[model samples]
Target: MSAELEGYEQDYAVLTAEITGRIGKVPRLVGDEKKLMILNVEKQLDEARELLEQMDLEVREIPVQSRSMYSNRMRSYKQEMSKLDTDFKRSRIAYSDEVRNELLGDDGNSSESQRAHLLDNTERLERSSRRLQAGYQVAVETEQIGQGILENLSQDREKIQRARERLRETDTNLGKSSRVLTGMLRRIIQNRVLVVILGIFIVFTIIMAIYFSIRRH
Candidate 1:
């Protein structure tokens, strides 16, 4: 391979490794962050593939007896890249599959967890309310010492209420993000399949052209 081709191959290899590493961890990631990471890696892979395709065309134009050898090398590089691309796609699908199950809450575990938390908080709030009422009555019946206790309980209740609101907002955001991610993943998979189909058509066209040319000669 030419120095330029060698350099391109090296860059492709490095990029593939980087992308593969990120994809491997996709299952561990969640929400929009995971989608963003996949998109970034996909962009990088696209740029690298474009460069490789350019190199492939250039290699095919080399006017020498060893042109066939160079072409073989180019094909090898493209095959490697194709395998890497497939692997990356499989990783993405695997991650999406895992996250889809989580989103569906297949076992009701997530709902159960949320229910348990709500129940716990409700019980705590009930207890706090009783204490506050008792403290208010104590203050009315006795001295002003219960006023201070009531104030503390009121502050605690406000904090807990704010926390629950924040938790609900977070859950809503996560649900929205998951739905968006699933849509994006489906679109990506469809596009990839279309690309593969288009590639096959192009290859078939090329073979036919070459075959007709040989027959005419």
Candidate 2:
């Protein structure tokens, strides 16, 4: 698997474990049917985690030899973006600083033509700065968007783990209850034929009493 993808998987598993371990204690401690809702949530979480893991595996199957290759690529893209952005900002700052210096009458050692030429330089600088700044902003925004997606995936993994823990607790409780109920039912119905015959006899007796009272009246 690709290193980046493996990193993502490890991160997801760790975060998921942490979140579920925190939330999963409630059902285990309480041991109530009311907490059964937690079981449903747990199932949903399990499915989501499975899906995410599968997706990660699928994405990482491309098999790259070096982990740093992708890291280097990402790092280079980010560095380039940062450098460009900084250069644009510095250019803008320099333009303003030059203008301020000139306006303050620091061009005393120069002629009017040279001073006018400074404005020309400033105009070009301003335009160049704006273009570079725009590109830089775009790059930063894209990086932020990518980070946000990673955070979201992590959050999803967390949700699923919590759910799985809850469902497990519920299943344990459910198994216990099922066994108890089965035993109770079996005990109550131990003498099935005798109970049925006794019930029929009592019903017959009641009917006979009712008939005899009516005839005497």
Candidate 3:
């Protein structure tokens, strides 16, 4: 691999690692802090995408005999980037749900006043009940969405594992091919040396025969 491509791969690894670490911190954060972290992660993701594009270009310039390995690496990087993006989205949704729950909780003022007002008015109580029902429906939908995200994450993990296994297999095959080629090369060099030695021997024998014939004549 060329030096340029190797540098890009290193940069991509670092950037992705940073993004992953930041994403992990998001759930621990709240309010503006979480928002800022998410924005930063998004920007880093864009950079990561650009790096992948650069890597793809570099891989294309490589010779076909060696390009498959680099191409596979690129695919793995892309899959990782996709997984990171999905995790970021999930984090945002979780943060939103957390904030929503906080707001929906019974605080001292608003919730208490509503309860007192409901006691005095039947119509208001009915309205409050309907709102609660709608909130319950939203909660159910959110739970379903969260479940789907979990399933997708599991699938992505499997794909990454398969990709890793394929890469290892490719490396093993390349190693075997290298050893075979080296052995073939060694044999070819030895054959050439033997051929040169035989040629010289044949020439010397002819020279001796000619000299002997001249001396005898």
Candidate 4:
């Protein structure tokens, strides 16, 4: 399970890093918020897995099928889009120094250019966002399936543990019974020896009394 989970996490990190790679800035999708979300999903998956193991459930990695996997991928793409959106907006807002002074820091001549650029970038960002959202939804659905299986596995593990404990107890009791039987055998042997000695003493005393009585007569 650990191996499976680690594989999932490794792929997730790689996907996020690749998508969010940028110039003069850290990876976006790998940022704290997204990272936390990914981590949380991972934790959930692990818990479910542990429960499954306890139940002796057979688990296997489905390979990029979990929500965290898709989310990690989408997260990277979204981060790249975010950077593009930020750049587009900032560029459209920036104006020539003279233009800035002439119209209260607004460029009327460049207004059309700004609007066109911003609009184009906005559409691209929106499209990317939609794609990411869709991918994220799929990832979430996969995680739900994982959770269900883990839940079922947990029950099986508990049953197995209880059975194992019972078997251990039975074994212990049998060991004690065997010891008791051995002690009884030893005591029986000791008593037989004592009875034989007592019998010999009684016989010797009776023979001496008869011999002494005959001689006196």
Which predicted model would earn the best lDDT? 3
User: Model 2, residue 39: what's the lDDT?
Assistant: 58
Candidate 4 residues 1-217, lDDT tens each?
3465456445545543443332113222333854464454445434433433332211223433444454444345445444544543343345445545565544366566765787787777767767776786577557767776887799799999999999999999999999999999999999999999999999999999999999999
Better of 2 and 3 by lDDT: 3
Candidate 4 local lDDT, residue 156: 93
- Writing each residue's lDDT as its tens digit, candidate 2 over 23-73 gives 443323332542453454455445435635453344434333343354344
On TM-score, the stronger of 1 and 2 is 1
Q: How do the predictions measure up, each by TM-score? A: 0.43, 0.34, 0.46, 0.32
Reference-based TM-score, model 3 = 0.46
Which pairs clash in model 4?
54-157, 55-156, 55-157, 67-139
Model 4 off-target regions past 4 Å? Answer: 1-119, 127-131, 134-142, 145-149, 168-172, 175-183, 186-190, 202-217
lDDT tens per residue, model 3, 1-45: 899999999999899999999998887678798889989998999
Q: RMSD to native for every prediction?
A: 44.1, 26.5, 22.1, 14.6
**Model 3: lDDT of residue 92:** 56
- Tens digits of lDDT, candidate 1, 1-217: 5687777767877887887787687666787987998888789889877877777656644544456676556656655665566556555544355665777657756555665676666556556755664574454334333444676798899999999999999999999999999999999999999999999999999999999999999
Total colliding residue pairs, candidate 1: 0
Candidate 2, which segments miss by more than 4 Å at Cα?
1-122, 194-217
**lDDT of all predictions, in order shown?**
0.71, 0.56, 0.77, 0.56
TM-score for candidate 2, residues paired by index: 0.34
